[model samples]
Target: MSKSRIIGVILALLGVVLFSAKAVMVKLAYQYDVDAVSLLLLRMLFALPLYLVIAFVKRPKDPEVMKPKVYLWIIGLGVVGYYLASLFDFLGLQYIKASLERIILFVYPTIVLFISRIFFKKLITGSQVLAIGLTYVGVVLAFSLEFSLEGEGLFVGAGLIFLSAITYASYIAGSGWLIPKVGATVFTSYAMIVSCICVLVHYSLVGDFNLMNYGMEVYGLGFAMAVLSTVIPSYLVSYSIKMIGAPSFAVVASFGPISTILLASYFLGETMHWAQWVGTVLVLVGVFFVTKKD
Candidate 1:
């Protein structure tokens, strides 16, 4: 491989690992009795300044006037993808293990495929159909195991994460169209900033501001999540896609679940079953097939 290719692979792997660590960090933060919205608020709050800086810095020098519809599209994608998806993910993580959360969230690609088919009238190839089937089968297998282990909250947790996947899929589907128009850096930064504003608004309406009065450990975890999981990986994944292309990064990102599983085991003491292992493998395989270039 060429030097750029090697760096791209490394960046892709590192980005996936950092993104996977997000769940583990959230689980840790929950040890402080923070609600989902509050925790999410803390994360976005820290990330807000960074995104603001980038949004201003990287904005076009000679900005073209955009249609009002384009601004609406960016705002809508931001709400669905980051704000809602993240809220659901954090709530689900309250009841589910980080490992299972990662597994469930990893199915967003298949969800995106279906979203494209339904909304955009994109053709669903035979391989995509098979990929979708395999991905759900794995989720079912994993959900069953989690249900047996976690009992009551299993359905609720799984359901929330599934919702998260759907919302994220919608974001991906919309972003496919918008990113080309907006440019990746501007689209990402602006969308995240918009999402951050939505999160703040939501927190103000329903969340306790006192929830911000936590110990240093909780604050530290939130800071780490903002920098490591949210901001850094965002750029890293974008750069990796720029360097090696999205298809290759998608293939390499299959390792994300494994990284989460291992991190959960070490940090959260979450044990994995054989069924989970099998399910993880199936999901990754399904993703591999779906993400492979034509």
Candidate 2:
């Protein structure tokens, strides 16, 4: 690969590493007794202004792209990508094992491939096909090791996570059309701000939002999740999408489970089975194919 391509690949992988740490951090934050709603709200509270700042400064001085259709699409993207997708993920995490949930959500890349093809008529390459195939095999192996069907709730949670993955993948696949018009920095800022507002409105009506109820650890974890997981990684991936395109970027996302597994083992007192190791390797192989430069 050329140096520029190599650099793009490396930066994308770095984003994935940061992305992987998110679940670990979220689990750690929950240790402080914050409910998912409260924690998500807090993360959005902090993220809102940060995104607004980016949007304010980055927007150009020239004639702006201000058609109602564009704004409407942005709103739709925020609702599907940020609010609804995240809501499903957080809820799924409550009922399902983290590992199982991660496996389900990681299917986003495959979903992205199909969604992109249908909506944009983007053709999938041979490597992309192979990468997706390997990813599913890896997902099966990963689940075999950590499968949990503990309750009726597990099935519900799995469905939620699957929906979350599909919605998220659609957002990622479709956002490419918008990113060029708005640019990654500006597009991400608007998406986040809109997403934050949606979550805030939801939480205000349904969530407790009690300041005194949550301890410092909970609040602190919430902020950490906001900065590290949501804000930072989302921005990084936005930039990655701009730099490398969504199809390639989604390939790197194939490895999201690795982050959860390592984190679970370290902090949650969880153990990985032998099949998990095989799964992780298979996932890496898929990631390799997905990310391979043309």
Candidate 3:
């Protein structure tokens, strides 16, 4: 690989690792008795100013004014992609282990594949079929393990995270086309700002701002999540995609679940059985194939 490509892969990996930590951080913050919406609000609240700064700094010089429809697309994506997806993820973490959540979220690549096929008329290749099969099987293995151990909330949590994967996959699919129109930096920053606004709006309507009066550890984790996991990784992945293209970046991102599992085990004391490990391997292998270039 060329130096740029090598650097792109490294950045992509770093982005995946950082993004993977988000679930772990969420799990940690839950120990403080913070509700999901409040936790999410805190994350966006801390992260909002940074995204605003990025949007201002990266504003187009001779501004390429897009159609109003394009702006709508950006806003719509911001809502479904980050705001809704993040809300579901935070809520789901309340009931699920971080490891299981990551594996469930890892299926987003396959979701992207199906979205393209259904909406964009893209053909599903044989390799993609096999990849989809393998990935779902892996998720089933992991899901079954979790189900056996937990009570009724198992499915509820899994379902919420599964919804999160769908929304995030939609973002991935839409952003692939949208990013080229708006510069990656501009798109990432503005879209994130939109999501931040949406999160704040949601918080104001239903969330108790008073609840934010938590211990130092809660605030610390929230800041770490916003800066370390959210802001930094979001920009890194955007730039990495620009450097290497989405398909290659997707391949690099297959490491997400493994990193999450390891981090969860170390930090959260979450344990995975052998079946879960095998399932994780299968999901990674499947994602590798799903992301393979034709």
Candidate 4:
């Protein structure tokens, strides 16, 4: 691989590791009795200013003027990808283990493949079909394990995470073309900013405005999540996509499930059964095949 491709792979891997930490942080914050909306609000609230500054400082000079529909597409994708996807994830984490959540979310590679096939008329190879089968088998295995252990709300949680995967996959598929046109930095900043505003609006309607009730630990975790997981990985994934395209980026990020499982085991004291390990390995292997070049 060329140097830029190598760097893109490294960035994608690092971004997945950091993004995996988000589940652990969300679980930790839940320990403080914070609701999903409140926690999400705090995260976007802390993240909004950073995105604003970056958007201003990195604004492209003499940029190609985009049509109105392009701006609309960005906003639509921002809502679907970050705002709704994140809301589902946070709410689902309330019911499921972080490991299980990560495993389910990792199925986005298959989702991305299908989105490309359906919307873009991309052909799916035989290996890609095999990859999808293996990936879903792993997801079902993990889901069954979680269901056996935690019966209540397991379906709901898994369904929510699956929805999250679809929305996120849609975002990745759509952003593949948009990023090249608008530039990675500009695309990421604007998408994130739009998501932040959507979160704020959502909070205003349904969330309690009394932020003084939560302790500093909640705030600290939120800020850490915003900076470490949200802002940094957002840009890393964006630039990685710009360098190597979305499919390769997804392949590099196949490490996400294992990383989240390890983080959950260490931070939240969540134990992984031997079968769970097997399922996780299957997920990683399947994702590798799904996105790898023939």
Question: Which run of 10 residues does model 3 get worst, by summed lDDT?
Answer: 60-69
Give per-candidate clash totals.
0, 0, 0, 0
- For model 4, which pairs clash? none
Please report, in order, the local distance difference test score of every candidate based on alpha carbons: 0.86, 0.76, 0.90, 0.91
lDDT of 2 by residue, 1-294 (tens): 677656666667767767667666667776777777777788888778888888899975555675678788888898889888888887777776666667668777677667867886878898889888997798678666444545577677778888998889878866878888877877788888889999988888998757568777877767777887788888888887777777677666656677777777777776767886787677667756765643
lDDT of 1 by residue, 116-178 (tens): 678879787898789878987997887787655788888889889989988987876677667
The stretch of ten residues in a row with the least summed lDDT in candidate 1 is 59-68
lDDT of 4: 0.91
- What does the lDDT read for residue 178 in candidate 3? 84
lDDT for model 1, please. Answer: 0.86
**Candidate ordering by TM-score (highest first):** 4, 3, 1, 2
Give candidate 3 misplaced runs (Cα > 4 Å).
none
lDDT of 4 by residue, 1-294 (tens): 899999998989889999999999999999999999999999998999999999999887864546678789899999999998999999999999999999999999899889999999999999889988998888887777776677879988888999999999999999999999888888899999999999999989998888779999999999999999999999999999999889888888888888998899999999988877888888889999998962
**TM-score of every model versus the real structure:** 0.93, 0.87, 0.97, 0.97
After superposition, which runs of candidate 4 have C-alpha atoms over 4 Å from their true positions?
none
